[model samples]
Target chain A: MEITSDTHSQHISKQFNHELEELKTHLMAMGGLVEKQVQDAIEALLEGDSRLAERVRDNDKVVNDMQIKIDEECTRVLARRQPAASDLRLVLAVIRATSDLERIGDEASKIARNALSLVEAGRSPRGFVEVRHISEHVRKMVRDALTAFARFDTQLALSVVREDESVDSEYTTAMRSLMTFMMEDPRSISSILSVMWILRALERIGDHADNLAEYVIYLVKGLDIRHTDPDQLDDEAIQGKS
Target chain B: MEITSDTHSQHISKQFNHELEELKTHLMAMGGLVEKQVQDAIEALLEGDSRLAERVRDNDKVVNDMQIKIDEECTRVLARRQPAASDLRLVLAVIRATSDLERIGDEASKIARNALSLVEAGRSPRGFVEVRHISEHVRKMVRDALTAFARFDTQLALSVVREDESVDSEYTTAMRSLMTFMMEDPRSISSILSVMWILRALERIGDHADNLAEYVIYLVKGLDIRHTDPDQLDDEAIQGKS
Candidate 1:
């Protein structure tokens, strides 16, 4: 009797561990898919590849389906497991993070659509160089933010948040350059508007990355640092590094 | 004994009905608060009232707190009552709607902050006329979308979705006009950039209103119309006088 009871307990424990691992795996898979969407969207813009743009639009379905699946799974876990404390927080954070990821997908799709249209309009203006600079910076921020998320590196996430200011500055310069193109020729207004839309999409992608980084901080420290100064975060590791 | 049992069943039913009513009332209250935030945010832009903008920002805390409370209430009801079918759908819809409402509150707060900055910077280069035009259209969309939500008027919601195109077109025009100003005088770039940001926020608000309208359609029809052509929805209600 004792031997049988022990075996049953072992089986139950294994089941519980499996469930946790499965949830984690699902979240990471969803993250991987969303990261690819963002990366490919950027590549499409850089290469002016309309086929890649169409792929981005088509892949949005997969991203959205993943969001719904993850959400349902989280709900099921919450309802069945009655998780408390850290487990509960993890589930809640996943819910919010998945939402941010889905939104990032939406923004990427917008960027791809904008890129497709811009490329179709033939050659862009001479000042498109400034947009390229802004896009590069924003892309870097997005990549680092996702990397920080995958590794749960709050310090790296904080740095990504700080880099947003530079992206904003670059965006400002691009806007001025685009504006100059518009004012010089009314005929250029249509083309300039397309570039402006693309810049707006890139800036928003950066904003969403900052949001993801904020979620990372919340998950690690159990603090809602949104709308608060990042300097307030006590980074012992960073202090030691300095 | 039979009479006593019958009375006991009646009392239980009364209690259940009361709880359901309470849940509905709380959800509606949350909606009201969110709708007010959107209205005030746009009003702040139209009137250039920094005080109103500040109020919108401050009130976001209430909206966020209400979200947490409503979420807890939803889960508690689900656990205690085991609602199914339409009741289940209603609860789920309320949960999703509250989330959208809270996000709308966030968007409004963002708009208000942008407006405050614009006011502090003196006059915007896009001119008050264009700002007013965009603000009025978006506000109307928000009001109509919320009305449709409250009434479950799919017809009205579909119209609101149609109106989003007009808002998008207006945004495109605004971008082109701002680009012209920037190209004409590089010095006006900063002011024009701020104006474009404000317009972008307004455009986003309109997009959210469209999202809310889509939710209304989903709640009423159990159809996911997102990313699909609105014209494809052949329901008589969605077709509505078109």
Candidate 2:
């Protein structure tokens, strides 16, 4: 009446696969929440809506919960299945990705807070249009980074890295304009500072997007491109394209 | 002469222990390198030394290499040993910590680059002294976070999270000051923007420190305090203290 060794092995393998798939599903779920937070934070900035800002803050809790849940699940799998090699890499990557996504959520929350403060301070002066430009640039970078992650597209991920330079340039311009504004009128300094916070938050978001892209590169190519000559990444991508 | 079952079991256990120790040692080595990078990056900013900036930039390669090597070692151990339970958590934590350390290195590199750019722009205006305050605060946070990580002091880690608010405040002040300066004189905008870049980098360093602290908390308590109520962490720490 006892189960055969073959049957037991098959059952264990099935359970392991199910757990691994669940881990991926949970990570993707967390990614969805983080992506939504980023979108809403930017939308709040553009619309000057404190309500949306509140919503982003509220959702951070859910994202945090998912992170913990996913971590526990991964650890449980590691203990139960003791997966090796490629499976181990996937598990490790998920753990790292969860942290990155959680930080992305934090950045979004910061942006929301900044947006609320900006609305309270009133609209920025004329030259502050640069803030909008930076925001749009960063938002696009984040969007593309997430897209690259979802599709496992290293090319798109590399493009996100390349675009980081543009975001940096925009952030530089915005800072200069804001600095000039602060010096011109100390009276509006507080309000102007609020706008700067929003801009800074957007910049951080761009950085997080870059982190996500780096993960995509690691996931797809098993390459540690973190400190490499970004030019090398581009060259490799170019070769692949041809 | 065939080895007995008892002998084989003891050999395997000994091998597992050795691999676990090696993983820990490698993680610490990587941690040390990343911590140095963060310190050097801050020093570069404070001293306005482009040479130091270049060194930090180059050292990122070393950090990246360590990450890949440590990751590979962890994978090898996982594959060969099939570690379970606490051992599994330790391996996974090392993998996660390596990633956080790599990012901490990146943030430091960014600070160095900002310093280099600031130097290129000539001396910052006298009013930009607030950057010094931010620099000191961020440096302290990074140091404390790394210390907490090394000691596995959850209390210190939680304190790092609490201290982030002060850094956030300093960043806000710096942003407002920069914005006012930009509004006053468009001519000084570019130089002031460079200053803001430095501030932004420092703020991000503080953020990374907070992240390290979060990881430390996870490592010690096996609880994910991220995105949860800060009060929850505080209460837990207080209980631990009592």
Candidate 3:
């Protein structure tokens, strides 16, 4: 009887582990979709492809579905497994990461909307090269953040956090240049505002990526580093863990 | 011996219930603090009070602390109790709500930072009256969302979700006006850009608040209303709950 019971319990534990692994896989899948969404949204804007922008908008439904499925899977695991400590932390971190990913999807949708508007209104003064630069950095941040979360790599996560400042600077610079361009040619105000909105969306995507990296660090090191100075994160992260 | 065992179990269950209640009360407290932070941040911008803006920046630490405390309490409860079903839902909802609340604080800080920049740059056009209108709507949405969550009122939550569209419209209108104003007068571009960022922050605050309301609906009804049509939320929420 004892041997049978031990084997039964082992089976249950294996099931639980399998479910958790499934949850992580789903999250990573969702992350991949989000990255593609961001890339496509930027391309739609740069090329003034309203049809491509509409495609990005439509793809958002898929991203939102992934978020809903991942969340349900998480709650199911929590309800069934009753996981503690690191397992519980991992589940919560996934939930936090999903929120960021969903928001990133929303940002992508916003960018796509602006792209459609710019296309309809007629694009003017075609130079948002700085926004393109920022988009490159933003994409890297999201990719690094998802990788860090997947591998439990605190160092990669911290580097993602550090990249946020550069993205932010890029945003500021882009805004300044755009403002001057709009002022220099009033005819471009409508279209330029659309570009500004798209740039804002990209900058926001970077911020959400940074937040995801922080969640990764929190999951790996058991440190709540959301509002901490990026410079101080390495020290605090090392000092805190259970 | 059986009698004592039953009594002891009942006592422990009551203690768990009490702890859950305390967690809720603490969440309400945090909600109140976030609402005040949003208000103060907007006030700083509208009044051009650098001192008030500085105070809002300083108070963000308190907001961050509340989020950490609430999150720690949530993780502890989940680990200790292994709550299932609605009990599990409540804890996860609180965790999600805390993140939105914390982000509201971050947006508030961003608003304050922009307020300071605008103040230092010597106030753009003095009439951010449209931004004031948007701020009023955002504040209402936050207050209503928290109340909806606290009371488990799906009707209120649905309304908050619907209100988001109006906020989005207001943001678009404000942007158009700001862009036209910036183009009409080149010298004011720098200061007006600050106001534009502040408006964007407020618009984002409304979005986060709408998300919080959806989480409340999810918790109360066990249906994820996120990414759903706001028009459809009322019916779906009513149909799905206990």
TM-score of 1: 0.73
Clashing residue pairs found in predicted model 3: none
- Cα lDDT of model 1 by residue, B23-113, tens digit: 7688778877877887788788777899999999899999988876786676566666655545554555666666667777888788788
Q: Is the docking of candidate 3 incorrect, acceptable, medium or high quality?
A: medium
Chain A of candidate 3 compared with the true chain A, TM-score:
0.95
User: What's the true lDDT of residue B199 in model 2?
Assistant: 75
Q: Is candidate 1 or candidate 2 better by TM-score?
A: 2
The lDDT leader among the candidates is 3
Write one digit per residue (lDDT tens) for candidate 3, span B1-242.
99999999999899999988988899899989889988988888888899999999999999999999999999999999999988899999999989889889988998899989888887647338987899999999999999998898888888899999999998988887877787777777778878888888888899989989988878888889888887655575364544
Query: Compared with the true structure, what per-residue lDDT tens digits does model 2 show for residues A177-231?
Result: 7666666765665666667767777777787778777877776766656656566
In candidate 2, position B67 carries an lDDT of 87
| TM-score for each of the candidates | 0.73, 0.81, 0.94
Q: Which residue window of length 10 is worst by lDDT in model 3 chain A?
A: A233-242
- Among these predictions, the greatest DockQ belongs to 3
Candidate 1, A72: how far from true, in Å?
3.7
Off by over 4 Å in 2: A1-4, A124-193, A234-242, B1-4, B124-144, B151-196, B234-242
Q: lDDT tens string, model 3, A128-160? A: 687688889999999999999899888788889
> Which whole-number lDDT from 0 to 100 does residue B148 have in model 1?
84
Tell me the lDDT of model 1 at B116.
86
**Clashing residue pairs in candidate 1, if any?**
A179-B183, A180-B183
